[model samples]
Target: MTVENASAPPSTRRPSAERAAALAIQHLLSRQDAQGWWKGDLECNVTSDAEDLLLRQFLDIQDKKTTHAAARYIRGQQREDATWATFHGGPGELSTTIEAYVALRLAGDAPDDPHMAGAAAWIRAHGGIAASRVFTRIWLALFGWWKWDDLPELPPEVIFLPKWFPLDIYHFACWARQIIVPLTIVSAKRPVRPAPFSLNELHTDPRLPNPSRRLAPVNSWDGFFQRLDKALHAYHKVAPRRLRKAAMSRAALWIIERLESDGCWGGIQPQATYSLIALRVLGYQLEHPVMRAGLASLDTFAVWREDGARMIEIAQSPVWDTSLAVCALADAGVNPDHPALVKATDWMLGKQILRRGDWAVRRPGLDPGGWAFEFHNNNNPDLDDTAEVILALRRVQHPDPVRVSAAIRRGVRWSLGMQSGNGAWGAFDVDNNSSLPGKLPFCDFAEVTDPPSADVTAHVVEMLANEGRSADPRTQRGIEWLLTEQEPSGAWFGRWGVNHVYGTGAVVPALIAAGLPAAHPAIRRAVTWLRSVQNDDGGWGEDPRSYLDEDWVGRGTSTASQTAWALLALLAADERESEAVERGIGWITLAQREDGTWDEPHFTGTSFPGDMSLSYHLYRQVFPLMALGRYLRAVQQGQSVCGTSDLPR
Candidate 1:
């Protein structure tokens, strides 16, 4: 590994990094929408596509075109072992395989078809439908393939719980809360559409469906929740008819009030699907206006490919993508007032969510001015997007200076006010670190609550420093929290991106931007840990398995986004000329495709660490450009790399 000579003459540094960044900038520009937003395809698992087919089947609206297209996409995702994994190259997941199998059956594939038969054998060996997650069982119940009574109880009366209660709606994270509220209505109705065919072949034993599993120890939290679920089940039987009716009505109102303007709930697919089914259970016909609008909203989540496959995005990410794109272009030496940058800024400014959303429940006095990840979600603007958007706005010399300034100020105040009790920040809510939501049997699939994470806090700290608030007491506390959270191995746990690489990448720059010297003990330790993990290919990669198994930390096949993350950290720690940085940069440049983009099929983004993962299409382009642009600037400066203050304003 050879390090670049930082003291060499101006044009003698790594020119490939510069060349690759230039080509990447043009590629990204061409992909931008006419409306001035950039959202790459958000690719997740086959469950989104499978659940989509299930929903259409339940509503008697499953058309041949959509069914065949979705089936093609699902078939393409099947692993060599004949099952679907939640992420690329990960192990086969039982529930995912189950959902995919049922969906193919609906597409007219016979059970004995080679693919279908192989999937059923895998499912049975893996404990079959009985061992799948609670949500999958509920989907089966809708088609009368599983008994609803055997599932955990989520009564409509749960809507009546006080906000101060342990399992109240607010205790769940915003995403889970949106789905749960509507699901309570579904659970109460227990309405089942006739089955198109039996799913007996997918079960471990056709005679004894939903075999009972052993209970947890009595004193444990899981045991307590198990008993509580039993109690709720009993209560469901003897409850007064009038009270249940009123409770269901109240829950219906709650779902209706929270539906986004685009007719989706919180700009996610699963939530919208459940909300529609819940309303249909309450007597809303397919021809009703709300149902019509919602069915149309679901259509937008579908991405029809050139090869005639239909894919489903779990959610869209326009605000997140556009903000990062602007920051990358600015770092690559685009003029601050370039029409592309200005147009993106104008579009971002228009997206400032001023109306108070669910986040205001805990922060009633804080003003509402933040950005959401999706195009139309107004009720759940998160701290991560708001901070990144502010950082992006600071890089651009927009035409409406006053407008940008006000938006920045509001964003800063709201972010500061959102700090959790422990002096950190979660993505959507304040101090939403509930312990009970996780123990509930029904929430066994994925994360049910939002909690403070190192990546989110790092972004906030970086944003505050750029806004000249580095010395503010709030920012100082955030810095302290980050230092304390660092692992003995010198990495932070990434709750959003792939494991340790992402967390270290995000934290190193934030700490430096907040005035920590390159020699700071924490910064040096992080740099050392990153250097140790450099892959044999001169890049960095951490598998999604790192979230589950300890040995997989900072280990996996190299990917473009993860490599850029590592490079960003090294460059921020004043190691631009180090061998690790040089080699990492070389790997990224050499890996570039002819189109100025890199092909990364791995899941680098996270929704629920081990259970759900994401492949943000724009991540491959934006992050590498940011890393290379900073390297180019460091070469030009002959010393320190370009920090936020050095960028054009």
Candidate 2:
């Protein structure tokens, strides 16, 4: 399968290292959670074999029934060339294919099995064992399929660098830093053992590249970063023993302190699993509290199938899911007085954290009032949750005024404080605009560090404006930032949601809330862009490519969620009478599933751009409800809307 790469150039010129260093320090200072651990999302290709192996090793559930069920599911994903992809319809990934092949082997599939043979051939054809990433090679080395010397050096001594250094520990993204901290200890110790079988058949070359060899020249900036990595490796040897030991001990304690009750580190799947194994090799016993809890947390990550087999999800998202549901239901006109609404609000109120979390470091002195994305992820409280929760509480008429008011004050204050000097806000981080982290040669993904985005900032602005605080300086600056961030074509770049449609939908409403007149130039420009992009089916849809490619604008078959997003934008701009709104509403009504949900496969939310996408299942219901409710309200008020006659069938 062919996949297009749509990585955009850095929108601005590269920052000087001095400037970047200062920014990194500033960003780091803002991200310190009250609990004293830095946290952020750990993104990886979810189809990796690490997860499959984790399920078997931790749960001891490699029964034949479970094995065959999982085998069938994995085999079904094999591409025409007999390999697997990290993403749907994308090129075969070497690490993913290797891991999948190994996973099947662990499930008792013989190397000679037709499916296994096919996967082996694909691996050999692609540079086989030699072409896989360092992380993949290290995993193999752990089991002795590969040699320790074949992996890049990730010495513990690197952690000793002062904070001001260009490649200091703090320079890496929070996720990378967390994993690397523990990994440094594991690497310095360099422990290796044997796997059950040899991967000799998997390689076209019997020998792997020397880890010390320079593979590519330091030509471009990315190339320069790779050389910097090599220099760090050189420095690894001959480092002072005292400093090395101190850094390792500090890093180890750093990792240990963040371990959640459930044996997982930071309650994220990758860190918890990898760190558990790493700590075990460092002599932590299986029965130890940290290890046992980490192992048990693996169960929380598993989802049982009808076949009695299980697939491990990277992490659960109930808090994020629930918040979106509440907003959707509220927008759909579910009265705040409804029993379900009341129940949800009460539960949400209970969940509101009254004390500061790790975010307090980045947002020093702010009152502790925000929500997290997971029921238990206290280390990573998010702005998205805070905004949604505020909206939900505002709709609840019977909420205890004292508690609700206090929560609102804390949340608003925290959010305002979290805004970057640029006048926008990131989701889980603040002023996380350091460019050096993304320039690291070890990084290949887009958005290595979180920076404020149009969608998230817009949501926060709208939430604050709805609270009757639109006139505040912070809110006004946020509005100015949104106006400035808009593309020349009038569209806004969506960082957390899909492409322009999501960004436009969110920013338009926020602009209106910030007191921009309906006829404001920015609002008009955004409305025209939405109208121009509406699909032929009387709805709106944008492919994920929009995140990667500017040229893929206006692409994808119309879907219910995108259509609803479009309708909401037009409604916010008082363009409900337009043909685009008519068609958008028509698409939503026509596509409604029998259960009152809409069926669409495209993911509507983005995490790390170009790497992961999320299908917010409730987006269809909530957005349409919101759009339809507003449209109906306009009609009742006798507004001269463009397409009132074309309500969905």
Q: With candidate 2 superimposed using the best TM-score fit, by how many Å does residue 536's alpha carbon deviate from the native? A: 1.9
lDDT of 1 by residue, 406-496 (tens): 9999999999999999999999999899999888878988899999999999999999999888899999999999999999999999999
Alpha-carbon local distance difference test for all models:
0.90, 0.67
TM-score of each: 0.98, 0.84
lDDT of prediction 2: 0.67
Q: For this target, which candidate reaches the highest TM-score against the unseen true structure?
A: 1
Q: List clash counts for every candidate, in order.
A: 0, 14
lDDT of 2 by residue, 1-649 (tens): 1111211122211122123223322333343343322222222343533455734543343457656666666776678887876544446777788878877777778999888898899888887777776667767777677776555566776667786676666556556676777778877767665467778878886664332455565577766766766676676677778887787777777778777655666556767766775677677877888778877776676656675545555555555555555555454445656655566666777767776655565666777778876656656677877887787677666456687778788888878878889888888767667887666644544456777889888889888888777899998999999999999988998887778888998889878866777899998999889988877667777777776688767567676667777877788788765666655655555565444545665566676666666555445545665566666555456563222112211
Q: What RMSD does each model have against the real structure?
A: 2.4, 10.8
Q: Over the full model, what C-alpha lDDT does candidate 1 score relative to the true structure?
A: 0.90
